[model samples]
Target: MTYVSVQTQIYSPQGWDLSDIYKSFDEPKFEQDLTGLQQKVAEFQHHYRGQVSQLTPEEMARCLQQLEVLSEQYSYLDTFANLVFCANTRSSEAKQFFNDTKLALTRIYNQLLFFNLELQDLDTTQFDELQASSALQQYNHYLNRIAQFRPHRLPEEAERTRNRDMLTGRFAFVQLYSVHRGEQDYEPVATPDDKQVETPAQLEALLFHSDGDVRYEAYCSLHQEMERHNGLYGFILNAICQDHRIESQMRGYPSTFHKQLLAADVPESVFRLIMDGVSDRIDLFQRYYQLKGQAIGQKIRTCDLNTPWTADDPLLKLDYKTGVQTLLNALKPFDVFYANRASDFFSKRWVDTKVRPGKASGVFSFPTFAKHSYLSLCYTEDYHSLFTLAHQVGRGLQFSRTRDRQTYFNTQPPLLLREVASIFNKLLLFDYLLKEAADDPLRKQAVLTRMLEDQFNLLFYQSTISRLELALHERAAQGSFDHSFVNEQWLEFYRQLCGDAVEVLPEHQYDWAGMSHIFTQPFSSYQYAAASIVSLACYQQYQAVGKDFIPSYFDFLAAGSSMNPVEALRQTVGVDLEDPATVNGAFYYVEGLIDQLQAML
Candidate 1:
């Protein structure tokens, strides 16, 4: 609990007020709501369990309307459990409550799982009749989505069995990793003096610090800690990937990736297209790294990929107040709606930015079914944190707006578009910075360098992760992938990505072991690459169309999961996910960025 941030000359860091979720976890209403939820689930099961297929369209719509209400309550309880646990990961009470709530949700969800299965079970003529009904006017998208899963539906008992097994199975391992991440503290890098860090987030901050020795020491220490636990992390990753592979096989999917593509409502063809696109255009990045070596006065290593290329870059340490204001000003050019909604984030305590002890490691915005979102991130005084704040603000705005208008089932935007809105806002901020620093060559160069680094992270780095995941999953389907095999594949991805422009460290092979997402969600990292493509196109469209792009973009965000990603992107950004040219266009855009940076240099 050391290093509690205090008020500085500019502003103070603060935590989000959880009052909007509940006054306190122990509030009487918390218990009352849990009890009420139990009763409602019982009533719903009694009313709708086996009768879903027999109901008329009006009855079915009414049932769904009621189910949405129940879902909101479930969402609130789950969100509360998660947020409380994140703030104090060692809290036994929070742990127990979150686990108990998850069990309860699974049970209730099993009861309602029949709703979609039964609707999907209807014969085609009757299903068509249901879709044709006026009562289903607003529920068409939800019904159509349920229909999409019809071919993948398993026997009811198997689905039920899997639901019950999740509590003690793969999901338990996720918590195991969380426990490890939360309790494990790190020794910070020495700036001629060694210091222990209070949070892993602070330890990670060193990797992007202005000191090379500090970055190296911290990188070694952090990776060594995770390396020591490689067996446990490997087990977690293997078990999760195996479960996914087995489930996909049982669900009649061709491969493990087919399932994730299904969840994203995208096709395998589109994923491949984007992957090949990014892979083909990695030369600019190779050149960028060469430029990095020139700027930093040394040959770049894998660890040094994170170091800033230019030392003369302007170091703008934006505090909390200034950061929020900066986001609003940058967003104002795109649309006032985006700017104003982001402003609400500060006025309403919707963000948790205080870098304190026992908080989560990374940044993410939690979207609630209650039509509001909460952002949690470890804020530092750097461009990375500033842009991340802006990033989550984009997600917060999307979730709040989507939930306000769409039904609970349809409120979540597809993963592909979810990253789009966040990254689009990020590009806007970058544009603003470049414009602001036009008079200063060094500042603009720094901005370009930073932007290039981001492109590398999203396009090259994430795409490599995706490639490793695919290779690992394919290999895992054959048998268990051990520590050696995993490490070798990890190193291969690094080499494949950077080619020979940067040196590789053997210790860096353990890097994949530390990525929590690959354990929790394999095959999902590619979505960042996919979304980056859509974002580049969106930004380019914004430039060409000017203010006229706002309404289209707004409508795109508001669409949520109502349409496929390809359709949405085509309509809004005029980019087709299936087209090879669309992929080539994104690479060309990155090349243009390198052109700008090279000219400036």
Candidate 2:
């Protein structure tokens, strides 16, 4: 049987037009926003910069209010470009608008560099007086955040140069990789009936193909193709590491990864728990692999890992409209404010759900706050796709609240806090599906097993990878970027974690190639594991408290980057980051789920 490549172009359905974000780039409002933002940035510099340190409390308050307005305007315009390009990445006009807008914003931002620098220099008496003022007290979180960074504050020109260089150099490696070394030749694999499957997506589906030979052939073939680019991938990896280590030294950071954790207010022990906890639980993964092999009556191969748990015939998939409706029905537990926002998001085309050729794989929701959250993904009606939708929508809700409550400087929320909303949505969907499938023993077992497997992937498998990321940076900090030694260390880590049941394919030892984090953002992969653990604790809170939990959850969303991550979690969901129990609680929850799945089997 020939399996078609899952092109996302076929998923579009009517009533999902994205013009609600903005009619088109030609709209008069787009031009107005652009011109208005440029003026605001110029005015801010002219009015506030030289005098910000000496300003009275009232004057400082007024400046912040103006800054907030300017932030909202920029978000609205940027969101419009984001929504447009996400809808159709191939649109040259949309792409050009984004480029033009970004360059303009950068010019405007260069003028606002004095805001933080001047504030850091404020006299202690003046700063304390401002903090005591009613108008600024609400922004205490924001004030505290800036004060914390005073130690790292550099001379304005030097800091500005470093920031600009980072974007132009270290950050550009991933973009270069995407351009030069992306997917290549199709080299189709033959099936038992003598047909071919070309794309990786097509090859993926064959993991469930009835013929074992077909699954094994596609597995080896896919990895073989990826192996051809090893040298190129290693070059990219080396460049990224060298850049990070050099910057960390210049910035006076103890370690490269330490810089990332400090910026997010995360502790090293929090990461260590995830890494070590996952390593300790490899036996469970071994059991899972053994059981999977037994169920399929064949040894598990890399490609065969993704096959469906059941042998049922594939169902006819719904188009995007029907998919949105299905998602809406699943999310009915939230209040009308939440539900209506989600409804508008789908109807207004906040999500670019169709898969177009050359569009990036995987899904991401860009949350600009105040204006809109844009989701980009190659959609399908698969169960996994639904989970992806849930993830994005959850992020949208958090963004919605933050935009309403915080200013632009505080908009990002810490990455540590940001992942909670997205992961919470995944948990919500997972719980709902588990309950819905409770009646059917086999289907329940399959769905729950898959859900647990996903948890393991995020909470365990990714945690191991996160450790390798941290170790790589530490070694690099000491001036060692030995590619051979690093690869061998990675293999050792995986071998210890995976145990005897699973074989690490020889070529697959270069697993680090697939990690986009290493090339793009250093030491950021651990956030997945950190957030996964925190999300589980938050999920339990939701279960225990029900509707009463909504207010606290919303408060968490609204906190943005204003508070340290540990303080934010404690304030929002009552999870104490320093306590080993919080991390251990996450593993215990997954272990319970695994035990439940095993009982069903």
lDDT of 2 at 545: 85
Q: On a 0 to 100 scale, what is the lDDT of residue 174 in model 1?
A: 81
Q: Give candidate 2 regions above 4 Å deviation.
A: 1-32, 76-101, 123-128, 180-225, 313-322, 334-337, 480-489
Taking all chains together, the TM-score of candidate 2 against the true structure is 0.87
Cα deviation of 328 in candidate 1 (Å)? 1.8
> Model 1, which residues run further than 4 Å from truth?
1-10, 192-198
What TM value does model 1 have?
A: 0.95
Q: What is candidate 2's CA lDDT for residue 507?
A: 59
Write model 2 residue lDDT over 1-601, tens digit each, in one string. 2312211222353223545456778888878878878887987888886888777777787888788788777767766665665444455786577657666665666677789888888877777788888878657777876776776677788777765675467655665564333335446899766877765545544655656678777776666665666667767777788787787677777777877777767778877776776676667777777777777676665555556555662321345655666566556674545656676566566676654444544566777555667776655546656666777888887888887887776777766677788888778777766677778777677667667766767766677777787777777666656557557777887777667656676756666665666676666667777888889998888889898987888899888876778888898878887787888888788778777876776
Candidate 1 on 364-407: residue-level lDDT in tens? 77788765898988877667788888888888888876776688
User: How many collisions between residues are there in candidate 1?
Assistant: 0
